[model samples]
Target: MTDGQITLTGIRAHANHGVLASERELGQTFSVDVSLDVDMDTVCDDLTHAVNYALVAQRVLDVLMGEPVNLIETLAGRIADAVLAISPRISSVQVTVHKPHAPVGVALDDVAVTCRKDAE
Candidate 1:
């Protein structure tokens, strides 16, 4: 494995994901950050040897918009799993799901869940 990483940050999506009924009904915006640890040795002039970030971003969006979950942790895990499935060159993935509009009833900047997965 090479010391190469692909990071995608600030991926925004609108989804209904919360424990509160009002939250589910109204929905909110979510931000996702993903990092993929991959081998960069094979990457040269061929695009096929490289991980397409566009595809990775799309994968995250697909999961974010696919279903509603009460916990961001679950959503993050799904994203990590999806990213790991992208390429065998990817050794591991880190996913962070941020809920900026969390109904905490207190002043807060954001609430987020981070998850990491290793290829088996």
Candidate 2:
């Protein structure tokens, strides 16, 4: 099998997830980025030999819009897990969850957590 990487960036969703009650009650926007390492054998010619990224993105969105979690770190981990579960060809995945309006009491552009998972 040959190794290759696929990346998806700037995925955005709205959810209520945080330590503070207000964060959960009011909800906010979240951004996600995903990168996957895969093994393929198509010489870059066949969709049948490659991962279907549209499906992958939908899975990530499902996680984003599904359950509520307390931390972006956990969200990142879940996304990594979800992507890795999609196909055996996916050898590893990295997910980044971004919180643009984190309730830190300080001004910031964004707060994010990144997680990675590998097949065992």
Off by over 4 Å in 2: none
Residue-pair clashes per candidate:
0, 0
Q: Write the per-residue lDDT of candidate 1 for residues 4-99, one digit (tens) a residue.
A: 999999999899988899878899999999999988865376768888889999999999988898888899999999999999888999999999
Q: lDDT of candidate 2 vs native?
A: 0.90
Clashing pairs in 2: none
Per-residue CA lDDT of model 2 for 5-102, tens digit only, reads 99999888888988999988999999899999989775768887789999899999999988889988888888888899999999999998999899
Error of 1 at 13 (Å): 0.8
The number of the candidate with the highest lDDT is: 1
lDDT for each candidate structure? 0.91, 0.90
115, model 1: CA deviation in Å?
0.7
